[model samples]
Target: MGQRTTVATTFGSAVRESVGSSLAAVDAELARRYPGDAGTRQPVHTVYVPADVFTAGTVREWGDRALAALDEHAPDAEAFAAVLGLPGELAGPVHERVRAKLEREPVEDLRIDFEDGYGPRPDAEEDAAAARAARLVAEAYADGTAAPYMGVRVKCMEAAVRDRGIRTLDVFLTGLMEAGGLPGGLVLTLPKVSYPEQVVAMARLAGEFETAHGLAEGRIRFEIQIETTQAILGADGRATVARLIDAGAGRVTGLHYGTFDYSAACGVGAAHQAPDHPVADHAKAVMQVAAAGTGVRLSDGSTNVLPVGTTARVHEAWRLHHGLVRRSLARAYYQGWDMHPGHLPTRYAAVYAYYREGLERAAARLVAYTERAGGDVLDEPATARALSGHLLRGLDCGAVGTAEVTGLTGLDRAALERLAGRPAGRGF
Candidate 1:
């Protein structure tokens, strides 16, 4: 109505600045919560043994026994080469390297499983077993014989067995702290999680245990097993993995796939409950999508076809197990479960072959891409990351040495380390 009304154009800038600041804060918070990858050394596989059978340095002892059996059966590098499908020229070196690794650090991760592996027992007996495990863990720590990563797998939080799970965890933690405090890099594995509430409850309980033991908050991290249908698809008919992670409140270290139970939940026949089955792939993809860039690790389930006896049938079973492990490796799941000591050879064989097969090409491509030399080759940041990750994993698992990596990539040790730590393209 007025003759000289002036519009306040400054308001838009103020609104923009305020919104930008708020968004920045939110982005910072998200980074803090998710925080990219942890850069920790993830074990290639976790070996589970029954709690009752566990003893101090049992992992080492079992590995030594397994090596003796392997020697008895395979006898020499050529014999082992036939089983691993390696060139005759590579047989002796591969055999000696694996043997030395087994002798030195046979078990990267060990799980004293109180769930399926140890079934149900009387409360008193279960408590005693938990105490024994605690004593063994402490002794392993004192003797420096503990695996680089170790944990205990408690039972599910189903209403019928929730108390048992809690009691076992409580007893184990109490005994562990009373003995010598929690071991470094120790984690708890919570199996058969079916709901976000289950994750929340477990995290809350872990927090309580830490507090009671005077340990720092978030010191007790746990891995969740995605076993049930509800675990993948929430009761609300939505994929609930992200929800589960959020419920963990930053204590979730990994999400492990449970092949058999998940297959059974989908009504798949036992004969068809396979790792690479379409349904299993779907669940793993969901987990990957949910956990990508969240710093939470992923592990595949085990192949139950154990190589037990020394017969043609046993060798066939070993071949099948090797194929399964290879398939898992191809899918970028560097970690899986090893159910029996007999699985060790195939585990290392598949892993080593995977890295070795891709080494030359991956190194060449990475070097070219890093130098910005296109040369009719198309390379993306994702490819660079994958190559770097492969090499880093190979180094971590002792499948390849630092000298080999540096030689192949033409990068010095420090550069390789920096490349491994960098976020792909930025450094490349």
Candidate 2:
């Protein structure tokens, strides 16, 4: 009966055009919100060195220095074991293993800083230094001494130093290109990005550099330093982190929080500026939310305390750094900045302890979840992914070996490998 009186539905040209335009807008917005594939191999930490102090083999040198300091302070594996609160039986072996790892791969990521680290120099001198850094990096790449992740931090793009930043970046890129084609995993860091426009400008400059050097169009990615209050809260009073990433036009690989600068922006006194300060926490939280699942990696700021001088002072410095690193790792930030060679040992120690301490529980939970398929354990996909990631990350950072993970989780090598290859948010 209803079919006998059926009515046809049609849209006028104007209405159809309007609907099409709205759909296109929605599609564009969705595309903008989509998180693209983040590259593989996010390093556990980044070591920042003054450009002047940088050399081709600086990573290995730092590792050697760290081991030497350990020898001087701890003297024996047992003493070092006490420092980390590790069992007496496991201390010596762990110490040797960590030392070997450090010597072999002292720095996962290295940043040659031209900002506070290098300060301002004569234009010609800065240019020469940039070129020299490029040459060293080139040599390091050729010699297989380059860190897996390496980059330079150029000055902020604020008006006062915008041109300076651009010039330094250009000089560095040109120098690096002349020395050799751009190395893999190389990223330029644009610091003190207080506005989205700064990110856009940096992206444009990177594109220009790539084109000028005949590099791939998207080869010149950069990291944004969330240093100022303005960077967190844009001029419009909205969260700016996502906007900043968008401004990078898919060239932003990481967002690193600058603890001191952010604390100073909050008017915290120098004595109060620490990585674990509430102010820093707020900044990191903002960054985490803004960049979560966006494929842009996040890094916490450095612990300014350096382990130097007498044994007592060195031990004290190590304690402070360890606390900071532990706090960062607890907060799910796998990467932070190491300001000195002395920070290397504590960085690895803290990271290893964090992962090692939780391995047993995490592995058990993961196995149960995988077997039961989420029954009494209340395991969600997120939980499974996180558990899998923990062990995989432990392996990646050299905190544990494949044999250990397999033994602990009852997962064969193939299973662990499968978990390692699985992206986040996927079921095991």
Candidate 3:
């Protein structure tokens, strides 16, 4: 047998000591700038309702309408799976979960839009609508019918509507405060952000609101909508989205792509302005990289195509939306916007199928990785984290049951969270 060899350090203790303080500063900056994912369940989709048309029953109404659409069109699991080209194995599970989700909590996130969806209105009219939206949202929460997340999308910070947008936001938040404090699920979205200054302004506004309401300093967080070309690439030739995240002051929860607006800003014709367009993909790719370790989520934009008209037309629209959603998921944009009730069925169907089809393989990989059992594919710790996150997301959206995941991987919720490197139950 060969004699054991001793290993020697390459650098002296004095050299490490000399850089320790500087490295500590770098460590602090990294911690501040690259906080990991917020462990809270991110919604699979955000449903937008025009503020003027929103009501306490809006969420349920959307669900019911989507259910009706499924009934009139793809009436069963096999039919739905066929529309989306779902695998045979996933047809039953995905369809059943989609229906159950629609029946139970169809709208994961609801945004009472005061931007493009709601359009401009008289000051008094907008104020009333804002207050009304707040009241209705509060009532929904009180009645246990509110979506898991609910908020409003105020108009842009462009000089034209800046003050009006601020006023509307104030009215809405005030109304929520009056109606038994802000709900835990309260969400806010600032749209058409073209500059980091605007993000800083938003953080300041949130800070002011917190101070005035005697709430925690960072209690009010908002998502920034990247609808302008400037938000993606500043005239300075720098990636502006990254600066926007830093400007958020730890209060930005998400970055939502605006398909039409961004596409138009890029001079793309309206007909070619779709989520899968090369321009759209580039914008989202920038967003994905910018938000990677910032604990900020990314949401893809919606399609204007509606599933109306004849059965064939509806089916065609469903197929298009499902393909777009699945493509977005494959690209790591897990959430998107649904502009109509008709989009809901396809949205859920696509999401459920994506997760269901990959559940077993992900679970098996995770089990192998955790057990240190060599498998066909060698997965690193980072890959193990990704695998666990996939399973967790599957669990979150009802695509896979906790029991099923546990049975497959022998991991409970806590184990999954640990492996995913997220603090259990952390959130906004």
Candidate with best lDDT: 3
Off by over 4 Å in 3: 1-7, 426-428
TM of each candidate vs. truth = 0.90, 0.88, 0.97
Range of the 10 consecutive residues with the lowest summed lDDT in candidate 1: 419-428
Off by over 4 Å in 1: 1-19, 87-90, 412-414, 422-428
| TM-score-better candidate, 2 vs 3 | 3
Query: Model 3: how far is 375 from its true place, Å?
Result: 0.8
For candidate 3, the 10 contiguous residues with the lowest summed lDDT are: 419-428
Model 3 TM-score on a 0 to 1 scale: 0.97
Please provide, for model 3 over 99-206, each residue's C-alpha lDDT reduced to its tens digit, 9 standing for 90 to 100.
899899999999999998888889999999999998988999899999999999998788999999999999999999999999999999999999999999989999
What overall lDDT, based on C-alpha atoms, would model 3 receive against the true structure? 0.91
TM-score of 2: 0.88
Model 2 C-alpha lDDT per residue in residues 188-283, reported as the tens digit of each score: 888888888888898899888777778788888989999999888877789988899888888898999998888999999999899889999988
The per-residue C-alpha lDDT of model 1 at residue 157 equals 90
Look at candidate 1 and give me any clashing residue pairs: none
* Whole-model Cα lDDT of every candidate shown, in order: 0.83, 0.82, 0.91
